[model samples]
Target: MTTTFYEEIGGSDTIRTIVDRFYEGVATDELLRPRDPEEDLGPAADRFALFLIQYWGGPTTYSDNRGHPRLRMRHAPFAVTPAAKERWLVHFRAGLDAADLTPEQDAQFWDYVTHAAQFMVNSLE
Candidate 1:
């Protein structure tokens, strides 16, 4: 049987690491920081970690707690413009890099993230 991406990438621990790193970048990012009004990013990081775990074929904790992702609806209030997407990608890419995924794994993951980022763009700017 083929190993799931979650397993191949080292499961929850690695996902947590990625989320932590990603939020580290987000905390200081001007474009992305304001989108999260929380003074502490811990909640956001936890939610994202769960979401990635479910997305990559791991446990279903995210949906178990939050129901369907409704990603667009959740992000609708934010001005997700092209520039914002790029800024988000920049930090996410850093998180991806910190994962040290294999070349093939990185490509696959990058493809998904880039596509998702573009899809999240609700504005032309």
Candidate 2:
């Protein structure tokens, strides 16, 4: 069976929908706090949305605008303890589950998230 990127999970709209929901959680998540106190999460949401689109075979907007995704480097300043990782996974899993992804797709997607979250772990103390 061939996997058309769109059909593999859903399509552009599904990506957009999931991203929007994920960012909504991030907006309120203490673990994934906004980098700027003076600004709300609107900008972060936009960036994350673009990145997800491109990552999930939708568009190249994120790379076009921001170049390569230096994810770990960008997050280096923040402290990603076990508690923060747990909190982040909670919100992320919630958003992903709410998207109604197929069981296989959900497992694949979650595996990526779990690994990514593990990779983002930069500190234990």
Candidate 3:
């Protein structure tokens, strides 16, 4: 009866903390704040938390609820310019700091965020 690294890091609790912190920045960031300033990020937050936990080898809550992430289609409405990309990364990096996860975990987490943000960039204008 031992917890995996996913559970060792506190599973959903840790994921919630990370998502909340990231969204807090997104809510106020100059580059990313305009589109969804007051939008309900609650659902989005839950989705991300579950997805991360599952990806880390925890439960499959994300897939249970949302099939596949299909992140690009989800973010297609927004104009993810370079500034917005930077802002998203800034908030995500801050969340990693707040989580205070191990260096390995931090690097892995940031890798996903970095690639995800890059993929979300739909325009060069």
Candidate 4:
């Protein structure tokens, strides 16, 4: 049987690391920081880690806990302009780098993130 990306990438621990690193970037970013009203990014990090795990074919914990992802709807309240998307990608790229994935895995993961970032753009600015 072929291994899923989640399995190949070392499961929840790796996912947690990626999310944690991504949020560390977010925490310091002026553009990305204001979107999240919470002072602590812990909750956001957990939710993202779970979501990524589920999306990558790991456990279903994210949906089990949060129902549907409804990503666009959830992000609709935010002003996801081109600049915001770029900033988000910059941080996410850092997380991806920290993962130290193989070339194929890196390409696959980067493709999805870039697409998702584009999809989440809700404003023209």
Residue 14's lDDT within candidate 4 is 82
List clashing residue pairs in candidate 4.
Answer: none
Show model 2 residue runs off by greater than 4 Å.
1-7, 34-38
| Candidate 4 residue-wise lDDT, 1-125, digit = tens | 99989999888988887888899999999899999999999999999999999999999999999999999999999889999999999999999888868889889999999999999999997
Ordering by TM-score = 4, 1, 2, 3
Candidate 3: residue pairs that collide? none
Alpha-carbon shift of residue 7 in model 3 (angstroms): 3.0
Can you write out model 2's per-residue Cα lDDT over 28-116, one digit (the tens) per residue? Answer: 77656654353666677678768877787777889999999999998898888777788788877877877868888888878988999
Better of 1 and 3 by lDDT: 1
Against the reference, the lDDT scores of all candidates come to 0.93, 0.76, 0.81, 0.93
lDDT of 1 by residue, 58-108 (tens): 999999999999999999998899999998899888998999689998899
* Model 4 residue 16 lDDT score: 83
Better of 3 and 4 by lDDT: 4
Best by TM-score: 4
Candidate 4: clashing residue pairs, number? 0
